[model samples]
Target: MTPDTTAPTLALLLVDLQNAYFEAPALAGVRESLIERANELVRAARAAGRPVVLVRTEHARDRSTWTINMRADGEGFAFRGTEQAAYVSTLERAGAIDVVKTRDDAFHGTRLREVLSGLGVSQLLIGGVSTHSCVAETAMAAFAHDYRVAIAGEAVASENGSLAAAMLDFLTEELRQPVLDHAASLRLLQGPLDAR
Candidate 1:
């Protein structure tokens, strides 16, 4: 008998790289670097013939789809027709599969899991904004769904740096996942899914 290996099935998941977060003055500093790093993953994924999934947050203006916090605040960002909901102009989004999520967890109320399943994506190399919220929740949900997960540290931004650090630590240490840098993530796409 011989050890059999399955072909690597990986997708690059880019989340919440929309104007809603990046346009915020408080997050402006991270916008440029984060998008650049994430776009690196996007380009590598495309060159490697891997699927790139865009997970973005959007809401309805009628208050029907607003979260509790949004409702309480009597306002919302990223409403469907708003420019805030649109992906940033610099992001590499051509030919990517799009999934709209209303909550922090991309898989919770969206077709993200099904999209991944349909694409036969057994592993995910994740990048994007708000590392402590949408990014963290999506990673945790992917873990729960038994998908191997990796994060590109520089590609994920947050309103709070400390919280982002904590979430990365939890994902790397507690969840036994890899938190990779931009170069390493490109290598992972070029070679094996488990490559460091």
Candidate 2:
């Protein structure tokens, strides 16, 4: 069959692939490989002239935007103007758009949905850190917004390996989203914008 011209364009949505997410030893081991995969997708998307959104979690230093856990524990992470809030330095982000978020769901309080809409993106290829939280939340929200979503399984990492797998399962089996590997994700990125 031919491509579905009615299908909206695809964009790469990377979630919370930041310095703080990789500092933990459990996730540190996969840092380099995740970066490698993310950078590859970034490059491919850039070369293809597709949108690449680098989403990060950033909270106010005064705990103004802190979630309940942060407020209860009297602590915060990815504070504004701090290195923790920054994206991982090695990822290819020169021309990509930046979407800063304070919640697990990237679209909760951010302009992520608008940003993607402005770019004419309705299909998302996602790869990010902490599979059970930010990544999962954003993917689910995207689905709710009627965006077709896919997770690049190999390009993501999590502090809890089992939870990560379970979330992937939920995204795939229950939500009916595809959890793809690196090669499959790359093919989707490089293929026709209207193809499914």
Best by TM-score: 2
Clashing pairs in 1: none
Could you list the CA RMSD of all candidates, in the order they appear?
A: 3.9, 3.8
Off by over 4 Å in 1: 1-8, 192-196
Measure candidate 2: CA RMSD. Answer: 3.8
Per-residue lDDT over 52-135 for candidate 1, one digit per residue giving the tens place of the 0 to 100 score: 999999999888888899999999889997899999989888989999999999998888987877776788988888889999
Best by lDDT: 2
- TM-score for each candidate, following the candidate numbering: 0.92, 0.93
lDDT of each: 0.85, 0.87
Cα TM-score of candidate 1: 0.92
Clashes of each: 0, 0
N/CA/C clash count, model 2:
0
| Candidate 2 wrong stretches, greater than 4 Å | 1-8
Give the local distance difference test score of model 2. 0.87
Candidate 2 per-residue C-alpha lDDT over 9-98 given as tens digits, one digit per residue, 9 for 90 to 100: 898999998888888998888888889999999888887778899999888888899999999999888888899888888988898899
